[model samples]
Target: MRVPVQKQERYIAIRNVTILSVVANSLLTIVKITFGIIGNSHALIADGIHSFSSLAVDAMVLLAAKYSILPPDTRHPYGHGRYETLVTLAAGLLLIVMAIGLFSEAYEQLVGHKSPSEPTSIVLIIAFAAIIIKEAIYHYTVYIANQVNSPMLVANAWHHRSDALSSSIVVISVLGYMAGYLWVDAVATIIIASMIAYVGFEECLPAINKLIDTSINKDKRIKIKEIAESVNGVFFMHKLRTRKMGINILVDMHIVVAPRISISEAYKIAETVRHNLLDEMEEVVDVLVHIKPENTMNSLDLPQRNEITSRLQEQSIEVVEKIEKITLHYVDGKLLLDIDLPLNIIQNNNQARFISQQFADFAVNDPDIYAINTYYHGTVYDSPKVFQIDELHDFIQDKN
Candidate 1:
């Protein structure tokens, strides 16, 4: 299937931002690693490793954006959006692993009582430049992510910001080391690792929630309900359900309408509600509307057609055999039936009147049935005409 133009534009924006991330991180990784070895600063080396990890995250973001935009298929009917979420989870896990490694190395250096070499002024210059460059990349990538509404891209932006933060901590430790505070470098490494671990956990949480089909926020739910109720012909709504699939939302709701309205009108009302929601909420991708009658009990609780037919048979009415269709309407807290019968049942006026009288007498004491209308279809009737029990009641009263 052809992808929509809007989605195509969004994917393009994501691709551009991710490419920018990859280029920036690649340069920073090489610069940090090259200067760290020359200046003998393990902190700079660790920071460079962090930058390299960010490059991996950028690659994941690019791969995810590529597949996540694929149009839905039979094998995956809900589309490939969740692939982005999985990529985000992978990025988070990578950060966590990197953090653990950094912490262990820092702890070993602290325990081994190794004297750290003081970095030259050139390393300080490199660290300052890295902070500036990575911070700029973070801001730019985040702006693009917001424009395209890509969660994975947002996660990657944070990765860039985290690298910038680590570089900032490295600068502080280097300054302290130059001032003869040798323990400062290892402590700073541990601190930066802790921060990275925190951000990783933060990224993992939203992705995990999406994977489990978590609902949107309460405020969004209220707004969606208001929008649905604003549509014309909707008497009320209930059984509303919502869940997140990556950045998109899915909604399922039951819309109540008047029982007497035609099915087509009810369907039109449902369509209107769906359209209004899609217009108002940009993140919503799909809405399922179930039509129901207002002010009625659950249909399952009411008597079934077979049960009603059995009751009529017990009364010797024998109308079930001639029934072409049986429509049960629940209104005003009672059941009203419209039974379509063959025209042969209405042979003459006397037979029609007697049959209507018999059904009326059967309904008079049955509290479940408020009224029953019989419709005849055949050559004689030409058109299906409804004969209500109320008309029979009027005729009997007139005779009395």
Candidate 2:
């Protein structure tokens, strides 16, 4: 499938931001690790490791963007958007795992009898600078994520935010170490790890719900219902269902229209509802509208036209041949049938009444038929004459 221009733009945005993130994280990792070693601050080293996790998230975002931009195909009719969703889930899980590792290492350092000397104003400055840079990256990524409506990018943005938060802890702990509180650095590492884990869980929730095909929020559902029912010909709507595929929403609903309306008109109403939903809701990419008659729930499993015609032939073989049209109405768990016949077939009003009564009797013994109605119409001879080609031409000539 060909990629739309808008979708191509979104892919480009995701790629650019992710590449930027990779560069920033790479530099932060190198700086923090080198300074942590030189300045002897273990907490700053763990913060650098947290920055490393951001690099993994950036890689996933770039990789996921490559496939997620593909158009829908046979194997994946809903498109490759779920690839991004899966990446979001992985990013969240990665944060949790990184947090656990940080926590364990911090715990070990805190309980160990060995103590390291920290003598440096430089470590504090580096950690503080990391906070500013990571926070800047966070805001930039978040802007791109919202612009493209990419959840994977959003998750990646939160990863940057978690890094910034951890860096802030590093700043505080470094300050404490300088003030003769050596345990503050270890304890702060544990706190920073817990914060990362909390953020990881937060990111995981939306992705999990989407994976399980959860419906969108109740407020959106209500708004969708209102939009569908607001259409001119739609009497009401039911069975409205919605689900997310990546950031896009897919909707399916059934709308009721007047039973006697033409199929073309009913179809027009359905099309209107579909268009209204797509236009009103920015996230809704596709909609399916099912048109049904009012009181459809009370409808019955009735015999179709062919079967009913056959049964009618069984009842009155001679009269069945005169039927010009047959209309079947399935309502209230029963079938109401209307049969049209030429007026010439009936000798008089009494005979017409007799035929009506005779056909009406068919419903008495039949389980599916609720009522049968017979309509009589004048023959062509009794109505205005139709013009042939020659007559029409002569008539036009005469008028001229």
- TM-score winner: 2
lDDT of 1 by residue, 232-349 (tens): 8898788899987767888999999999888899999999999898878888888999998986774556677788877887787766566777788887677888777765555455
Model 2, span 233-337: residue lDDT tens: 898899988888887888989998987677899999999998898888888887899889875455656788999988988986467888889888777678888
lDDT of 2: 0.81
TM-score of each: 0.84, 0.87
Which runs of model 2 end up more than 4 angstroms from their true locations? 1-5, 113-119, 298-300, 342-351, 377-400
Model 1 stretches with alpha carbons more than 4 Å out: 1-5, 105-114, 301-303, 306-325, 330-334, 340-353, 363-370, 375-400
Decoy 1 TM-score against native: 0.84
lDDT of 1: 0.80
Please give the distance, in angstroms, between residue 61's alpha carbon in candidate 2 and its true position after superposition: 1.0
Candidate-wise lDDT, in order: 0.80, 0.81
